[model samples]
Target: MPITTSSPPIRQPCPPGTCICNRDALLDNPAADPRILLLTQHEEKRLLARLENCASLDDLRKLQQRMEQQLGLRTEITPGHNEVRSMRGIRIVVHEQDGLCRKIRQSIPAAIRRGLERNPEVAYELLNEHDLLRGT
Candidate 1:
């Protein structure tokens, strides 16, 4: 009897300007990139509200951990030394090689607008509570 083995199939290159290959690559290793953390509008609103409700650095830290656990997105919160009651800075770290960071940044304004349109008073209250609303 002759010994024979089948060769592995070759992968064809994806067409130009198409994301078929990229999508397949992501499907193969979803955990390799944090771009999966992209949030829907509803999720963004809920997260923003939760952020606004944080009363202290401890609260913010807890929220950060929750986000990391639930969304796979890492965040850092920095409280101002002079202002013990407020979070002065927040950084959301993610892989930027694939433009996910820019996409998230660009979506913020639209999300806030939608939130404001849905409930102006609640939106204002949340933003003001977090010292994000100017001249309030």
Candidate 2:
């Protein structure tokens, strides 16, 4: 069996004792206004953020929720939602950017180049500086 949907049946008193129009007849009339599909409130906010360039971390999280529904993997997680939100998504390589870690598994070559330009001797000492900075 297939389910059918139409205008919902509403009970209204017949004026002056005339019978009310039957529900089946009302269902035959077309709807005055058709429904338009809409993005969820959360999704709309996310797109605005990307356009407006002022989205907070929390706003991104809401957008992420929507993307996770459609695109997936907007941010990396430590395995669960924290008590707080943080900036995540689309990793960027800045002229000088490195994760703070106990040991430098990856080196900031760009930063090293800048340092080298400052002093050729310092460029030669880049690895040594990393070892020293990590206190290893």
Candidate 3:
């Protein structure tokens, strides 16, 4: 004897105001923003430490790649052409569509200032090694 298959049941729409089917409509709206992830203090410290350890532009590039992979943050670094090799520009790209990029960008300077206050030696080392003191 051959096995037989039965047709699957059809989905029926919920009656008006009877179900929460309209919840999906909220997702369809264009104005809805993507969820943003705010970094904790510990995470920010870790990021700063990693940045402080960058000895060269190549190291910074590697750190940038690691940040993208680990934290979903896109970092762009522009090298300066001065007596000391320094970062001409540093910015976080909002390519992930998350709203955290702007906050992170705003907080970076303050974080760096705090870190420098805590340990000026490390900051000096970073400046001497990677020329990351001028524009950044």
Candidate 4:
């Protein structure tokens, strides 16, 4: 005997009134505005901590539910809002910006070297001195 496999059948998207397929339609629609994740700085930090500490798939799922609850609370607090909405896409913008900042910071050392080439003594003095008057 030989085992055989078959792919699932492709089905048409559900009609607008019949199911929640309208949301999918909205996503595909060009006129709909791009969605933004509404998490605050504190919320984003906590969510990152939760995600980092998630040990298993089940733990991750629970964290997801908590995030959903937070989103629901936000929605209740700020009804009739056009821009802010919730989705599973969070932490991405923060991470991207962090990476950009890191790159900028890394280039600063090279910039300091260039400044030193122009005037070595003043640049070295500035780099070496730190908070002498601050009692550190």
Candidate 5:
């Protein structure tokens, strides 16, 4: 018989955010107010590193404030419309019936679910690729 070898497993694109890797993590929580914030891998890493190196309570508070702005929550609520702030803090108003917001909400959860099924080893690979893991 001729000797044959299987090809290596195909790599997937890097997923955003921390994945809920196991059933235990999925079953462990019942939040009072359930919400999802979808962030990319780099964004999550930056958030974690910043949290670790916070200089003082004041720094921590400032960090929180900055995060709120970054998350697009630092906006005035006007009734009956969806309001988004531009980079220059100008308000861009859109109707509540806009499909873009709905699509965003739906897509994020789907992406997270896809992330849940990713191979566990991929996490290590991600850390390695980003140089977050060092010294073996």
Candidate 6:
């Protein structure tokens, strides 16, 4: 069985601010071109580290803002929270820190992937080669 890709590459003019990754190159040769993976891994570490060190809501907000500026993502901090009911309708309190953690886990990977798609070169520079981790 062959892997079939469905989305046809659009040849129409690229919008002014869009940068399309040469996905064909990436898909054809991943390990041979280690840049994209390295970049993504680095961004993931940076974002996760920042998220972990957030001491308060304000700190989290600042980190989220920085992420937004860097990657065009708006971190939605639903302050003064409420309860999320489970499938069984049991209300689970949403603590601010827990919410922040959830956001970090979800957003960091997304931001990393977006960063890779946009700027793999920077990503590779930021990551450690032997470990695939973020380089300080």
lDDT of 1 at 95: 29
List ranges where model 1 is wrong by over 4 Å: 1-25, 28-35, 79-103, 106-136
Which regions of candidate 2 are displaced past 4 Å?
1-52, 77-136
The lDDT, on a scale of 0 to 1, for candidate 4 is 0.35
Query: Total clashes, candidate 2?
Result: 0
Q: Identify the superior model by lDDT, candidate 2 or candidate 4.
A: 4
* Cα misplacement distance, residue 128 of candidate 4 (Å): 56
Task: Tell me the tens digit of each residue's lDDT in model 5 across 1-136.
Answer: 9999985332122233433222233225554111123334455556556644544434544755674555432212121223222222212232221111333333333332233224323334433444545678
Judge candidate 2 against the unseen true structure and give its global Cα lDDT, from 0 to 1. 0.31
lDDT of 4 by residue, 4-114 (tens): 898433223344454432435444667653222234335445555555454443454465456446442111111112321222111122112111223322332333234
RMSD of each: 11.2, 23.3, 13.0, 20.6, 20.3, 18.8
Query: Which 10 residues in a row give candidate 6 its minimum summed lDDT?
Result: 90-99
Worst 10 residues of 1 by lDDT: 83-92
- Please give, for residues 1-136, the per-residue lDDT of candidate 1 as tens digits: 9999985332233345643225345546756653333454457667777665545445555776776675555543322335333222222233233312344443433443343445445444544566865574
Model 3 lDDT per residue over 1-136, tens place: 9999985332233355555423234336667432223345467667777665555445655776776775556654332344432222322233434334444564554444454445555445555565565464
Task: List runs of model 4 lying over 4 Å from the truth.
Answer: 1-38, 72-136
- What is candidate 6's lDDT per residue for 1-136, written digit by digit as tens? 9999885332232243343444344446645432222224456577666655544445555765675554444444321223312111211132222112343345554543454335444334333332344445
| True-vs-predicted CA distance for residue 37, candidate 6, Å | 11
lDDT of 5 at 7: 50
lDDT of each: 0.47, 0.31, 0.48, 0.35, 0.35, 0.41
What TM-scores do the predictions have?
0.41, 0.20, 0.41, 0.26, 0.28, 0.34
Model 2 Cα RMSD, Å?
23.3
Residue 26 of model 5, lDDT score: 26
Q: Against the true structure, whose lDDT is highest?
A: 3
List pairs with backbone clashes in candidate 3: none
**How does residue 36 of candidate 2 score in lDDT?**
10
